[model samples]
Target: MKPAKNSPRARIVRYTVFGAISLAVAVITAFGYLRYEQRVDAMHPALTGIALQMRHDPAAWTRQERDASEMLRDIREEKVAAIGVSRDAILVSTQTGAKYFVTDHNGAFSNALLLGEMKAGADAPYQLVWLPDANLQTGMARWAAAFDKIRDLITLLMPLMLIGGLFWFMRREMTGGAQLLEESPTLRFEDVIGAGEAKAALADVQSYLTDPARFTDMGVRAPCGILMTGGPGVGKTRLAQALAGECGASFISITGSYFSAKYYGVGIQKVKHLFELARKNSPTVIFIDEADGLGKRTDTGGGPAEAESNRIVNQLLAEMDGFASNQGVIVVAATNHPENLDEALRRPGRFDRTVQVRLPDLEDRAEILRFYAAKLTSKADDIDFGQLARLTTGLSPATLAMIVNQAGLVARKAGASTITAAHFIEAIKIARIGDVSGAERALSEEERTRIAVHEAGHGLVAALLGTGVLEEITILPRGGALGVALVTKAQDKHLYRETEMRNEIQVLLGGRNAELLVFSEASSGAAQDLQEASRIGLDMVSKFGFNVDGNLFSLAALPAQYAGLQLKNAIEHANVLLRELDDACQALLRANEPVLRAIAERLLESETVSGETVEQLIREHAAASSPSMHLAQEPAAA
Candidate 1:
């Protein structure tokens, strides 16, 4: 396995290697200069005398020298002492007084010593030596001469080294576009929390992958692609990983959005490259998270981004159903919006199977809670899984895991050794709504009482209507709401009848209804309630056609020409229906005024009340009105 270059250990090693190279280069260069200086010092005396003459008269040295520059170039690398002009011939001498002829003297003498001149200078030598300035012939100049060959060697090697390095980098990038995780995936199906149907479907796929020969013998080809559709935080990506792990295959994961680009053909090239990587690593799982982005419906309208997206989609389709079959490669894609995906990508030869990873139900929630809680070192048995499951009705498996983590944090904050039920309750509240204890304390007593009355109203109405199981009623300010009555459905409901819809609207307006019944006026606390109630009313009339006397006209499908008028008439009819529901809510609250009063009183005393306490109060109120109910029942029997 290659260590990431950005990892601390890798970075430290890289820096150490670079430093060592630099230090070695510096040492070698220093040693070369020192050796050159030692050689120059051996000819110091002769060089000193020549330098004095050159400084006094430079004209005599270079004036008769027609090839002075060439002579300097040729001798810079050589150790020479002096040079002189003897009539038309130039003479050179080393430090030992040995003479050498320079220039063309009688046709055949260049840097050649003259034996007769040595004897002539033995008695009384009369020689005028011409020399250049010592400034141009020592220290740096000497070192340059000593290291000239080494410098040439380095210069010659540099281009070859650069070319080799470039080739290696390009090769690494081209072949390593996606990491080939040689190790089998560690995630297993048991590691996943919910989505039982998705898990079962993926288990079958894993069987096909793990036993390819068995499938082939049965004349069955494995599905080329699988598309997991779900909302965010529903573990679509995790399911894909679990599939790979179950089959013990190499998992190459990438995001679909990564293939999109502003350039024309870059998207297409990247898509092809990704598939090629998968093929190279056979029996690979190519998991694309957020696949809808790359495989979106390709429309006829043209733009740079749209055209690029279309090209990426086309490339992906071709790779899935191309000429060669990808027998060993399985493409698993995840998307939150499967409806936005291209139809061609979902065809039989491509992603034939679409699995829905829906939100966890009560039992799933409890299982998810236990799964996460068991991973901790704290005491998990003290926490009631049944209550938690009922409380967290609509939470996804991801959110449930977070709740368990937050529970641990709460316990640690209070210096507890084990997470208890109180910690879980507090964590659940904090997860659903923000921690608002400080904000609650900021409110005056009058404001607190008003919030208590508001939340109590919602709780009473919800209990009366049997809309859902009431979890908790609290006066604490949370997430910009003055108060909240948390209700979770007893079970998941796919469709709603007209009675349930109307009851839900009534419960929403109950807070305002309570304020009017008790204080003879409503407060700004009911603003959110009114907004929610209005949205439901609009949806009921426009989207579902619950109003308009069973005409069954879908407002969403209305013609543009008459849409405005139709919508106005529908809303007007819905408003009349809302007025009737509001009256019904107020009448119901009045008939059960004693129940509402008792719950509001208990809330004001405690600032919060449990669901069980509310239920007990409702039973007591019903018992107190039994006589009137018996009298009404007698009239019905007669």
Candidate 2:
């Protein structure tokens, strides 16, 4: 029976036959061309100068005949049989049918003349002709024939090989291109840290996946899809996996870029295949990480890439919305840039719910640190999770985990049996800034002194103003900075008062002010300090309504239509506030020159001074300067 044309078996048979025919035709044509070349070469030998030389002068003919006779003597004892010189050429033929032709320059001999000469060669008007050995000539001809056959065979097989390779690759892509993870996730909520609210939000989806029949009977459909939006390393993907684990469902994971293919329609096919897999494995969580790869579509026409992206997104939407039954399949997608996702994918019925996974806060960071620390062989009491959490404000859970692991590494490198607080501190420094220990040894004495002065100035001003708890002051270069003054709040503060903002600006400018007071001129080392101080000043004027003019209205809060003159006034006011703050910082540095000098001197000796030591220096200076004044007790570690 004849098979259908589009069937896989039929297609394979057709391709095989076509490839075989093409290969056969190629071999035949190549062999025929080679044979024709060989025949042409035999008819007209490449070397023709010997015949021309013989015909050029009759006086030299006897000498040439003697030379040709000697040449024949070297060829395995083959004798000179005959010489046939035509009008245009002289021909020498070997017994093995190899012919050599040499041209005659003069018109002294014709073909008929040569034939007559050959017939009368035994007695009249004959010349000696060189003939090659029959055995050697036969062996060379056989090698040439073998080489030609090999070349023809390669030419024959090339097309077939290419076709077969293409067929195999296409079949593989059709059958197993889209990877699906059939195993259920092993990551439970207990295994995950941070994203507490996101976990709470996904609890409903977990319930639905766990018991789809209960929801189906009550006419309440499970959420078709969940979209997770967050910054990178905030645990959106972890949350999705945890949801899968919570319900003991099969997990199929793929990135948004998985639907992208070089060929058209392939992405759409992948989307269809992905959905089919999810359906086959009911109670499955299909996690698509980096969903922004689908891209936001436009109404205006674009290139082929844009069109393909649109088609894939459309197919995904269709699959999500066209499911015949709930089937306990939940489509979960995570994107760092949710705004870059297609609007169609974010529609109500399609995504059904959106969860935001934000950076871990202080308590959450502490929790994450504790979780990772428990996995390490460490002195548990030596590691201060609260202080580490306070220092790592705005850090993600991933970063917190890294801090723990890096601490373990640092401890091991130092030949310590267990991790310690000092190791965690070093790890935090590495994570926050980078390894600065090597860079510290490279600094010259002058640069070290300058850096020490700059960092001491920052630490002193922050402590004096009570802006926050002074953590550490170091002249060790970190990242782009030549020095650093680490500060942390006793607790996370979501709102700041105007005085607190101003005090923060003053601390930022203290480094530059200290430079001016000590060196009689400020260096360019305070460029970052100045920039940060300016930003805070501008925010106070335009955003926070803390302008010196007491204008309750925020310039940034105004619409663009009304911001022409108001924007300029806000900027002018910000500059005035910066000048005022700068003067205050200079005066403060001048007044506390003795304490600043003490801190900078200590730093120059140690390269790094603890915040408590800096605070102690300030307290001692205050007490000595004013005997009757009362000093506040030292603040506890954050």
Candidate 3:
């Protein structure tokens, strides 16, 4: 039996690529020609400048005398064929095989070595012919006579030549030219992770695409469209393409941006062209990435430009709702902001199936990290995949991939065969923020002591709390801070209890508390730390109503009731909130000082402490006379 045949859309893509390549080659050739012409023009100026200088010279003869002399010279005629100019300022007639040079007396000199000589014409001898006073004037006159014809020839041919090449390139670009069907793309189902719930939701879509006849038999219309909505970077585009590839359907991918045109009818024309192309290639999936850009909601009061956008969108709606859409054509569109899309486009018959792509859960995150990790060099075999995944609490798959690549580079540089767990830990930190460009600083002995003590206070408290809240405390600078203590939970949770919120506030204030005890005044280095801690602590007391004092009652209700009103209220609330935040923040840092002081005194003696060291100290210290592992993640500004 023969193998399955190749798909049509694949053929279109292959041809399109070929056309683009041909166009690229033609453009390169044109550029080369232009450059050559420029160089020739650059050199022409020297000869032209010389001629201009000669014509404008004070010693030049009158026009009538020059013209009469030039006519007389021409009327004298050659022996047979016209003589051409040659090197040594001589003229050679090929027919007569004779050479003549212009003598000082304005007469032809035969066999005159002193004057100049030209060999019988074997080359373009006209190039070197000299011009006497009369000949020079006549030679310059010929240029004006010939300019019209030469320029017309160039003008007529150049654009036609360009168009011909562009047409040929487009033709080639739209053809397949024997593209292998097997290599269309695999898009294995598993490459898509975390959206398993989404995948599960969309399972029926495959049945609809593959067996539309089943619905036809039941006298029902199949879904001709599916919408994938998700946050940015959640792989909505990837899912659509993968599905098309997996189903072996013809995939014609174009951006929604491509459909929005400034010209009145152009957008509608493109839409018509796209759907026509889709209909011609049945079982085709038109994947428009970010379709909201094209099919935005129609506002009656919108301007002319928005009207143009709406027109294209209406055309798209017609194509989808019309009989053509149900005839083996499926349109899959992805957008982060689905709410912004025009309602007509996403109506029941149009974008009938909505698939929501979301961030992968923890297990999914682990799988994604593991897949990327496999490509990295000698990553430790038992490097705690679960633990690493847990540490990357809110990280996305894309971010995870970047982390693995960065750590692999670090491993490569260290001459280490395997990427150690430590390497990934560092990569995670680097990825979370940016590079630790200012990590190493010339710290005074006093500054180091203060920093060591401050960080220790945060690390010690979390260690003591056993909240799984503080993950790691590294003295190494990362991000804007010179040092940091990161907190994460093993499992991802959307909601935080009041206690969890307070614990976070405590961690933020830990450094400030330690600072006040170590130095008489709190360092401004804890500015961000204080700000963050104060806001949360204040919000808890005032807004969230989670505090003991009824000072929280002084706060107003939440803002976002009406659209414009919300923004105005939010601004006003921000001012009052700032004051509450400042008071609560100061009070928290001040109240926590006694406990923080003891922790800092211990940390001041210690140079660097990891999670392990913090835990050890937590075990060793018991409240006032007790040891604490809690440290504020606040590091000195880099």
Best by lDDT: 2
Candidate 3: stretches off by over 4 Å: 1-98, 101-152, 159-184, 295-304, 442-446, 530-608, 623-638
TM-score of 2: 0.74
Candidate 1 yields a Cα-based lDDT of: 0.77
Question: Which lDDT tens digits does candidate 2 get at residues 1-638?
Answer: 99998999999999999999999999999999999999967864543444333334322332222223333442334432335454333445434433443444342433333434234335522243322211121224457668998999999999999999988866554333655565778899988876788988998899998987787799887789999998888998888888988899988888888888877787787877777877777878888899898887776668888888888788888888875554778989999888888888898988989998888888888888988899999888877899989999878888888989999999999999998899998999999987775676787898888888888889999999988889999888878777889998877777999899999999999998898899888888888888998888888988887978787787666688887667787778889998999899899988889999999999988878999998888878877877434333223322
Superposition-based RMSD of candidate 2 using all C-alpha atoms, in angstroms: 12.1
Answer with 1 or 2, whichever has the higher TM-score: 2
- Per-residue CA lDDT of candidate 1, range 78-179, in tens? 445656543334545445544444344332332343222455437312333433222222224447666997899989999999999978865544333567
lDDT of the candidates, in the order given: 0.77, 0.78, 0.63
**lDDT score for residue 542 of model 3:** 53
Error of 3 at 84 (Å): 12
Model 2 — which ten-residue stretch has the worst lDDT? 130-139
Off by over 4 Å in 1: 1-176, 213-221, 261-264, 295-305, 543-545, 557-565, 625-638
